[model samples]
Each structure stands twice: as structure tokens, then as C-alpha cells.
Target: MRTACFIDGYNVFYGLVAGTSFKWLNLPSLIQHIVHVEAPESQLTSIDFFTSGVKPSLASRGSQSKEAQDTYLRALIAKGVVVHYGRHQLEARNAPRFISKQSPPSRLDQVAIWKLEEKETDVHIAISMYRLASRQASLPAEERVQQLVLVSADTDMTPALKAIKEDFPDLRLGVILPHREGTKRTTPGSLKNHSHWMRRLVTTEELAAHQLPERVPTKKRPAIKPEYW
Candidate 1:
């Protein structure tokens, strides 16, 4: 049977950026690796990646530490990873953060940075799954996508996933957990509706097998001001 993979770029990336300090993985190649682990019996027909186009440095986080983020994201696209993007968001509000009053002591010499939060990533993922699901079910006149496997932890996607399972039981829809700290999705009634959540993609050591080519990265992640705060 033909299998398809979908990735929630923002959801998965946020987990890595928050939980761990390392952020170097060949995403396109990563999907290739995930294909085998998720559907060992099937070959991938598509791997649609969804995310917003905003770089963290200037948008919300303002962290130059995220310098290589755009670089790697574009690299995935060059390798033929399907990328879906949403616009960056801007809002005005009281942005409270932590700051040290150096007068206290050396331990109090730090500052906190905050910015507007954009929430279009989840929307993009939902739309893709819905579109693919509809295309797979209704048999689109334009294209035909076989099986679908959504990779993310956003419980918001539960409804769409359920649609595939109930409406198209034979469609082969599965959910993938975003964080892979040896953790698993355990919503009390999550699987009661559908038990198809898989683990995250390839580990760090196996990055070589999943990296996109060398040329693409240089183009997508251009020379933007550093994002480190």
C-alpha cells in the first residue's frame, strides 16, 4: 500500500528548541528514516512539512541562538521536502519578562525576552491533513494521496485524525508524537478514539541518512541578523 507522511514543523521544532540544546538534524533525510520506522511495510509517496515562514530572531523569540534554524529549514525544502508556510503575527501587549538588577549580585545579571506568539503552524497542519484526507477519500480530480501519517503532538488534530479512522477506516491514518524524550502520548481518551500515535523521527546519530543536499541550505537560510537574545 502507498504511504504518506506529514510533519508539523513548528510543533516538533519547539519541543527540540525548548527541551534540548542540540538542533542539528537532516530533516529531509529524517523523514526518509521515519518512513521505515513508521510504516516498515510501505514506501513513502509524500512527506508534507507544515510551518510558518517567520524566523524566531525578529518575530517573537528574538534569539540569535536560532541562527541555524532557517538554514536547516530551507535545507529540508531543497531536498524535496514539501514545506507549507504561514505568515508571521504581530500584536501589542504588556510583555513582562525577567531582568536582573546587577545591584543585587553577579547571580542576578540576566534578562528575559518575550515577543508576539504566532499560532498558524497548527492551522496549516490541520488544513493539510484535512485536504489530504478529503483528497484521499473523495478521490480528488487533480491528485490522489494514498495513506496519511501525521507527525505531531498537537491534540487539536484529533478531530481530523478521527475523521480518517471512522470515515475511511481503510485509509491508514496515524498520529506521531512530537517530543521523543522516551515519552509517549497518553491522553486518557485520545486513543479510545484512535490508537495510531507513533514516536518522533530519527535520533541524532542517524542524521547522515536524513540530511537534505548541501546547496539548498545556502539559499533558503540567507544572511539574516542573528536571532540570539
Candidate 2:
């Protein structure tokens, strides 16, 4: 089976890599491993990774964070992954101040804050997936992507999955939630409903084994792993 994978980069980072030692992940290796395990007949043909550039001012590690992201993105490109860039928008907005979890938020008690949103990523992923499905519909059976795998836990993608399932019954759909081992997270029912199969958790051993080399070569220079990572 010919397969193509779509990745929601922010979702995977927050769900699996945040506060973890697996920052230097080799995305293609990991996804290919998962695909082979789930369906041995699958031959992963392409990967499209959607992400926004990191804002240095908003990052915990400031400039270092941005630099790390740039390096990592370069490495991914060098390894044949197609990257789609979105953008971060920081705006001032009003929202209810959180007092306690027991107390419901009231609009009367509002505070002004800077809201940073990663724009266009979700829309981009959705449109890209649907577009791929549409294109595949016209291709010869041997050239078409028989399976489409999504590497995300975000429920926002449910609608897109639904459309593909409805319009292209012959195309196989799969979801791989970016939840890590030892973490307890509810399975997204909507995504599961649309997918032919779903893989709920990624093990630490799998992550460790699929990490990129300490230095990844690019056309200009070698992308080195950040020391803090």
C-alpha cells in the first residue's frame, strides 16, 4: 500500500515532546516505524510537516529556542520531509482571570493579556489533506496514496477526516495520537470514528531509537543538536 503522512507539528510537540528528553526527534523515521508496525504492507511515500516559526521573545529559552527550531527544520528538509510554514500572531485580548478551577469564569471579571496564537496551521493541515485526497482520486490505482496517516491528537482535524471518509471510501484513513507512554489522555472519539485505525500512544523506547544523529548535514552546514535539548 502506498502511504502519505500529514503531521501537525505543534500538536505533536506539546503532546509528546514538551518537558521530555525527546526533542531531537527524527519525524520520518518515527512515523515510518509506526506505519510498518501497524500495516506491514504500507510503503510511506511522502511526509508533509506543518508548523509555525518560533517567536524568540515568547519562547522560554528566548533566542535559543528559535535557533533550535530553525536547525531542526533544516534537518527535516535535508531528510526529504516537505515543510509548510505558518505564522505566530501575538495580540492583546481580554479574558476572564482564572481564580480557581472550582469557580466558573465570569465575563465581569476580565483581564487584558497578550494572546499568542499559531495561525493557519490547522487550516493548512485540513486543506492539504483534503487536496491530497482529491488529487489521489484522479491518479492510477498504483500511483494513488492508498493510506493517509495523521500524526496528531487534535480534535480540530475531525471534520477533514469526515469529509475524506465520505468522499473517498477507497482511501484508508489512520490516526496516530501523539500521546506519550505513561500519560493518561482520553482518546478523541470523533477522530477514531472517521479513521480505519488509531494508534494511541508512542513509547519512550521508540522515540529514543528514532532520534536524529547529533549532527545532521544540510547543503550549507551541519545542523547540530542544541545542548539544552
Candidate 3:
């Protein structure tokens, strides 16, 4: 069975890699592990990773600089991970801020701040999943994708998965929940309910085993791991 993997970059990062040293990930090996252990008969044909680039001014908000992110993205590309970029919608708005308890009860502080929201990643992932799943209709039976794998815990994808499954009853659907250690509920109920099978991603053992090399040799300058990563 030929399979394709779609990963939501921010979702995976927040759920799996945040506050950890496992930022340098080897996506192909991880997918291979999923296919080998769960669906032994399946073959991984491609991996689609969706994400938005970060801004340097927002570094205080736990975002990496564009240069650092680019290096990591380059490494992934060299490893055959297809990356789809989305833009971060930056906005300024007034948000409430807490003041000292001694302040008047009726008084509240409205501070102006900049907020960054990642857009289009979820849409891209959902569209890609359906598009790839539908390719089985036109391609030769052997060459078509027999299984569609999602590496995200976003419940927003449930409707798309359900629609695709209704159209392609024979296509296998799997979910790899990107939950990190200390997480209580890894898989969202809606996503899990729609998937034929589900698995937890970001285990310590698997992450350590699937890290990209410190230095990924590229045709141009090498894609080196960020020193602070």
C-alpha cells in the first residue's frame, strides 16, 4: 500500500517539540516508523509539511527567527520533506492586563499588543489530504495512494477526513497525534473518532532516534543546525 503523510507544522511543534531539544526532527524516519510498526504492508510515497515562517520581532513570544527557521526547513527539504509555507497574520489590538490588587475594582488596563496568528496551514493540510486521497481514482491501482496519514490533532480536519472517506471507502485513514510528554489527552476525540486507527507521536525514544544530522550537506552551503536549537 502506498501512503502519504501530511503534517501540520505549528501543531506538531506546539504539541511535540516545544520546551524540548527535539526541534531537529527527521520526518522521513518518523513516518517510516509509523508505517513499519502500524501498517507493515504500507509504503511511504511522500510527506507534506505545512507551516508559516516566524518573525524576528516576535522572538519574545517563543518564535524562532526567520533565518533559524529557514535553516531547519532547508534541512528538511534536503531530507525530501515537502514544505508548504503560510503567512503569519500580524495584528495589533487592545487586550486586558492585570494590575495590582490595590487598584480600583472598576479600573482595568487595556494594553496595545501585537498578536500573530498562523493562517492557511490547516486549510492546506485538509485540501492536500483530499487531493492526494482522490488521486487513487486516476492512477494505476498499484501506484495510487492506498493510505492517507495525518500527523495532527486538530479537530478542524475531521470534516475533510469524513468527506474523503465517504468518497473513497477503500482508502485507509490514520492519525498520528502530535502530543508531547506530560500531555493528558493526546488525541482529540473528533479526530480519533473519524480515523480508522490512531497513534501517538513524539515519544522520547522515537524522537531521539529520528533527529536530523547536525550538519545536512546541501548543494549550496550546508544546512547546519542552529547553535541555540
lDDT of model 1 at position 188: 36
Best by lDDT: 2
lDDT per residue (tens digit) for residues 133-226 in model 3:
7777898776888889999888989998888889999999998888875677645788877778888655788888889989999778999998
Over the stretch 79-172, how does candidate 2's per-residue lDDT look in tens digits? 9999999999999999999999999999999999999999999889999999999998678887999999999888999999999999999989
TM-scores of the models, in the order given: 0.67, 0.97, 0.89
What overall lDDT goes with each candidate model? 0.59, 0.94, 0.84
Q: Candidate 1's C-alpha lDDT?
A: 0.59
Ranking by lDDT: 2, 3, 1
Better of 2 and 3 by lDDT: 2
Candidate 2 shows a clash count of 0
List the candidates ranked by TM-score, beginning with the highest.
2, 3, 1
User: Clashing pairs in model 3?
Assistant: none
Q: Is candidate 2 or candidate 3 better by TM-score?
A: 2
RMSD of 2: 1.0
Every model's Cα RMSD, please?
Answer: 7.1, 1.0, 3.2
Better structure of 1 and 3 per TM-score: 3
Q: Give the clashing residue pairs of candidate 1, or none.
A: 29-210, 30-210, 63-227, 63-228, 64-227, 64-228, 65-228
Candidate 1 residues lying further than 4 Å off, grouped into runs, are: 17-22, 55-67, 94-115, 137-144, 182-192, 195-197, 200-229
